[model samples]
Target: MATKVKRARKANFSDRECVKLLDIVDANIGKLTNNNNTLRANAGKKAVWKMAAQELSAMSLVQRDEEDCRKKWRVSSLIGPTVTL
Candidate 1:
């Protein structure tokens, strides 16, 4: 019998990639807001923008988690309570 081990897949993406995606979303949003008939009529662009927003949000969450982990691993000194005369 063979045992299968589940491995966690990394969701790491380069900052450049995230920035590019955000740029695309911003452009699309601008187009949609400009009353551009072509862009307004295209449902696909809206879907793409939604997906990009989701991706950006996910990346932000990942970054926050990494920062929290790093903070957790740091050594901290405990200060004794101060007494006032």
Candidate 2:
């Protein structure tokens, strides 16, 4: 049997702190994907790659917005929210 370590909530990271995340997402999307699948075609691969890159960038923006909203809420003294791990 193995022991488990308690996980703590991640402190909200700001936009500037999320630079590496976009790079990692871009570099890893196809790395974990099965490109041989039929939903993706050979000629369309480049376009798909570009779209994935854009999507990851958009996700970074979304994360920043979400963190900002959460921080604003906390600053306003909102509570009764239980963060689940």
Which is the leading candidate under TM-score?
A: 1
On a 0 to 1 TM-score scale, where does candidate 1 land against the true structure?
Answer: 0.32
Best-fitting candidate, scored by lDDT: 1
For each candidate in turn, give its C-alpha RMSD to the true structure in angstroms: 15.4, 13.5
Residue 45 accuracy (lDDT) in model 2: 48
Full-model lDDT for every candidate: 0.45, 0.44
Candidate 1 accuracy as lDDT: 0.45
Candidate 2: tens digits of C-alpha lDDT, residues 3-84: 9999955445444333433344346556434467564454344454444445444656443333343243345335532332
Error of 1 at 34 (Å): 12
Residue 11 of model 1, lDDT score: 56
| Residue 6, model 2: Cα distance from true site in angstroms | 13
